[model samples]
Target: MNDMTPRSFDGREYPYTPQDFAAVSAMVHAHSGICLPQTKTMLVYSRLAKLVRERGLRDFASYIDLIRRDPAERQRAIEAMTTNHTKFFREDHHFRQFERDVRPGLIERLDAGGKVRMWCAAASTGEEPYSLAMSLLGPDPVEGRVIAGADVAILGTDLSGAVLDVARRGHYPAALSQDVPLDLRQTWTRVSGGTMAVAPMLRDLVRYRRLNLLNAWPMRGRFDVIFCRNVMIYFDEPTRERLVQRLVDQLAPGGHLYIGHSERIGGEAARRLRAIGQTVYRKDAA
Candidate 1:
């Protein structure tokens, strides 16, 4: 075996400085809620470098400038940096909790002349909201339930436009149906060319829109359940506190909030919200 180690053809190693890493990390946090760790410097450089090369930019700094100045370029960068690691019912327990605990409570309130509204914040590529749609509407399915999925990125915001072109088509691998029960799979989705699409009836119950959680939320009306799951972990404590409070504001009295398993809202803020179970919170009626 040769003693020489592998090296770049140009003999110039990639330069990843502390400042350079901080700049990109800050940009990511500003645009999306994702917090890039210091260890992810290499990942940021490697992934974004491809964009720089594709756009014929000379370096990372130039690419950042271009993205900041150009709306379309910024959108591409937002899509690139935002984590899209979601699958159908990724956290099964949450869905189960929705069915067993939350849904019944919601239905009781709805029966007493109330309406149910749900927001899926950080909805990536449509799986989370679509899953919620299926669960809330149930098998028989009725109209008029309001389910909204929102994201800050163009790919997420324009979900009704070019962003949803693929999602509207509703194609996922057959393996995705593995978690969904046969009855629900048959009721909510249909297979075409070994892919799955949410049924039109169920799709009509949910609407996808562009929303930036960091900015003023344009939404009107309080919600019975807000599925802001797997998102708050990206923010620093202050940001998290602010976002959590905003989410709580939108929640109707006695409403429910679902977050990622790894996150928590503590102290006085935690007092306003009572823990229902693992990763679930109920807003105090008072």
Candidate 2:
């Protein structure tokens, strides 16, 4: 925006004008619901600059024109710009709450010939859903018991197909496994070549699918608990509220919804849910 701000990058002087930045930001928000503030000018430049080069474009203005013309390229641009940082058992306190208060009730349903349904709304690279799988169906691999073999299912979805590719592979660097408890880690991960592969049992418990939070969801029925965490921080309030309401509709009565620790719901969406814990809310059973 100004001389001090990063208008240029690498070795080249940034040729795009402020109007160019604004247009790109507006297009991204309209397509993905992620609000890129003017402060993120550098971020936008950093993420898309390579694409400009790859496209053989001379400047950001030309790059924007190409994205306008090509739907596939636009999708690729969205993938390139998205921020995907997640870990196993991230927001540990929420997992603690689930293991204690939530699991017991869901166990009751399992005992009644029902299945425990959990959805990781943004299953970045597979960690969150796998951690949830371990928590839902215990660490041990007993095939027909209270948990280790209980009737449970998890659905993991994210807007980014590239990250979803990583998710389906079910592997992560060993260092990233630290957030997982020792027993669960040992039970669920097979270590080799310095990366941990999630055990078949755990992987089998969850299904990974590509989902755009701002687009139509093909899912049916409701979930006992839904984790739609830090993904909303990039969205403006109106977009956030709309997404929250849709998530609420997919939640079973009295089911829990987990958002990012720093994210919140407002207006009618806020009224339908009551705070149960940090960034966790319970839908009114009525």
Candidate 3:
């Protein structure tokens, strides 16, 4: 069979045609702003095959029809299509830059009885936001408490409700904690058996919400630091440009924006943001 042909050797499963792939791809883009290329045909098939079987549907066509009519199933399909590959301190230098530059001003604001905010736009399973929390708070103890009191909030938002549940729990396999810095890991995380849990201090500073980037955002205030890394790669040029503009609009003056290393600022966002470090941009202070 060709690339477009379904891999049903025994004819026991549904035949996934090129048309089905195209339909699923378009539906994903329409609902989530994610661009699924032909290269992802097998990925789409593998991810949705279980759903089709669970629904007792023997064909991809019926599964597609059901999703088009059922909002809950549509959400599930989108969530399944989403790629949530993240780990603590995945980009170590970003966190280092954040601590060396971004945290000082935020700490100053907090000291002066001002509120500071951070947003992890693609906070898959909560590692990115939790990393931000650890970077902001550091290893120092305050008044015998490991968590230093501060007027700060880190908002972690993603389109996957299922991942949001994991983010809220702040638990992971113990092996995943390896990427975290030694001091930060010891201070901000707890390890028991094969499981690692983000310390209550880190959890206290972060909150998770299910938010579709293509949909309307209800947030009111600007963020001092926004981490929308590794997400724009899934979007087309127009979608990416619009999303960056929106991110800039929600960014506070003098705030920092960190994106995927492979992604670049374009169009209006290029003029609005200044590149300082690798994949990091800063908005001018008012």
Candidate 4:
């Protein structure tokens, strides 16, 4: 096997060297569809260093190799890398758009006997998808709809077995709850021990799963709206273009694709998808 020994960093052991980082990045991308940029060396070192020590692995290379071979070890590595930073309704305007523009239009379509499906592609820790569920399933809301939240992490893929254990419990600090609207707060969420959990009604409306966007999507039907936000920024231009095309292919006629505010789909992807707003794309009806 390769030298899987851990290196010392700032008096702590870390996996050093481009080779070590590359190996781990390949493994993560293959399993999760998240592309770790080359500049993210510090991020890799910082995130995985503690795990190395905690697991008593000698070096970064060995640890990665072990993970590659052992399914359980691979799961641990996925857990370490997939811990995303997020909050309820972190991007308020997007949710507002969902309510003010998307929801109304969708309701009109539904009244005409149309059904809707929405996918939250990188539903980190379940905040964005849960927020969407509340918007769609709240009192006096759209009657027929399907919402699917998928992430590459074990928590999401394993049906919230561990990561979602915390998510399903629906507890967050009071500060996190403050950003949620008061009406929404009263109707959509429950508070206990300074942590807020999404109401069961909303939670039940959204289904969470494990899916890697880089790989083939298992769902057969097209989607009317896809929130693949804030995830493509980590991928290379080629990767981004390919991922965008896949998303567009999964979109229904006149469907809208929402990307991260900072990300733009270029190359052939730009031709296939027309820009709708600052960070939104619309597929042609033809």
Candidate 5:
């Protein structure tokens, strides 16, 4: 890993070395708690090289230097390196589990004049929270809080402002809406300019905010259902474990917690949470 290393990627010249990637890995992990493995050198370069060039820097080393000198520039690098891969009902089974067990149980509680809250902790582009909205309340006004006789709200938060902006817009490419069920689509979205716009009712049910899970959480209430999927894969064991425990702290008694299909709760979090389905756990009523 010399300073002069040069590699061509995606038809562009990148003067990044192994050292540069390692520095990036350390920086992002510290900033966002996302561990970028060494294997993603090419992917990292491909995603960040443009930002380097945009900053009038010649290479990764230059960008790293800027981050070292100017803390503000580090946020740009964090934004560039963070991955936000998500889609509506990306894991259909989780939603199905929601409909089968979580929904019925939660609605029963709602019927008993209880307030139920849901958090899509990694709500990328609004799909997941909107899906929850469609589930808890329906696609229109008729089935909302006015008629449901319960307090229901969805808080959708993400670390990326870029994606949060998109989430607030309630619009998406038509292809991204393919997984949406036909009935739900007709009820919740209207097609325009080859994109689907979420119904106002559905939008009304969700609040989008920019939040870093590694930082302080401003949310003050307990949630009955929490969806924080496909995010912990990037965090190391310690960070993941701590995050799981924090999530557990945000849940009401017997509240459900869902993680990515590949993630598992360990240590005390595991002892406190009861596994209910594939990648789904519920806080024990202890």
Candidate 6:
């Protein structure tokens, strides 16, 4: 077994050198704010190996050369490296807080002819945003009537077009629906065979788009709630700080920000956002 070669599950070894790993790391970091430490070497190899094979590339080094010159290939490379590990109510406390605290005001705002918005910054496969929609809309049909026709929008964005496509479809394996509250499941999801689809009423409130967090945001208005959980762990400190500030800027006064349980806000944004709950921050109302 060559130490430099990464062996796949099928016992195929891909030639992945430190130099190749570094090159790929630099490229990924430059395009996306994600930091790729040496620890992720095997992960990088495993994910990109298929791409390398599909393009008939000899090795990661050659694949690196191709990505440098080809914008499209570079994008494919970034997509391959992106981690989209998400599930319905993966962090339940955040949703509970949103449901018990932030959502009521949003409902009131909508009832008074105001528009309400929520953004899922790293929506992976639709679960997080769909979860948000379900929570915001609620399970009790009578209490949910106000929001059922309200002008509320949920924007789910991610860097990967592939995952965004899955999110737009609003379908998931039925087993994953277990995390959804039983009442919510009955009201908002349709189970068929081994798969489930978010109901059209919930789906209609969501819009999926490809958004790079490092790039300029085209959104004009502030959001009442933003779920950017579990995404900043891959970014370096400086990148994470800048991103926190940007997230705060997008927040409407008195709005809420939800992040990964393991993550924290730093720099100026930290001062502006008060820690209201576990991994939850709230901007003071103006």
Question: Which prediction has the highest lDDT against the true structure?
Answer: 6
Please identify model 6 stretches exceeding 4 Å from their true place: 1-14, 142-145
lDDT of the candidates, in the order given? 0.69, 0.85, 0.89, 0.70, 0.83, 0.90
* Each prediction's TM-score versus the true structure: 0.83, 0.92, 0.94, 0.81, 0.90, 0.94
Give lDDT tens digits, candidate 5, residues 1-286: 3455445574457677899999988989998999888788888888888888678667788888898888778877888887788888778888888887877777777777878889999997888898877766654546554524467788999988889899999999977778787767877778887988988877877899999999999989888889999899989999998999999999988999988878888978898888988989989875
lDDT string for model 2 (45-88, tens) is 87888888788676889899999999989998988889899989
Worst 10 residues of 4 by lDDT: 147-156
What is the model-wide C-alpha lDDT for candidate 4?
0.70
Candidate order by lDDT, decreasing, is 6, 3, 2, 5, 4, 1
How does model 6 fare in lDDT?
Answer: 0.90
- Output the better candidate (1/4) by TM-score: 1
Of 2 and 6, the candidate ahead on TM-score is: 6
The clash tally of candidate 4 reads 8
By TM-score, how accurate is candidate 3?
Answer: 0.94
Mind sharing the TM-score for model 2? 0.92
- To one decimal, what is the Cα RMSD in angstroms of model 2 from the true structure? 4.1
Report the alpha-carbon TM-score of model 4 versus the true structure. Answer: 0.81
Q: Which stretches of candidate 3 lie over 4 Å from their true place?
A: 1-12, 143-148
Per-residue CA lDDT of candidate 6, range 61-168, in tens? 788999999999999999999988998998899888888988878888888999998999999889999999999989986666568687889999999999999998
TM-score: the better of candidates 4 and 6: 6
Please give, for residues 1-286, the per-residue lDDT of candidate 1 as tens digits.
Answer: 1334323445423334567678878877877666899878777877787777688655667777788789777767766766556777778788888888876666565556656778887776677777776676555534213321211111123212334455555667877887676766877888778877778765665667766677777778777778887677767888888888888888878888889878888645676788888888999895
Best by TM-score: 3
How badly does each model clash, as a count of residue pairs? Answer: 1, 0, 0, 8, 0, 0
Candidate 2 error regions (>4 Å): 1-14, 143-151
Pick by lDDT: 5 or 6, better one:
6
For model 4, the superposed segments whose C-alpha errors exceed 4 Å read 1-10, 37-39, 138-162
User: RMSD per prediction, one decimal?
Assistant: 5.6, 4.1, 3.6, 5.5, 3.7, 3.3
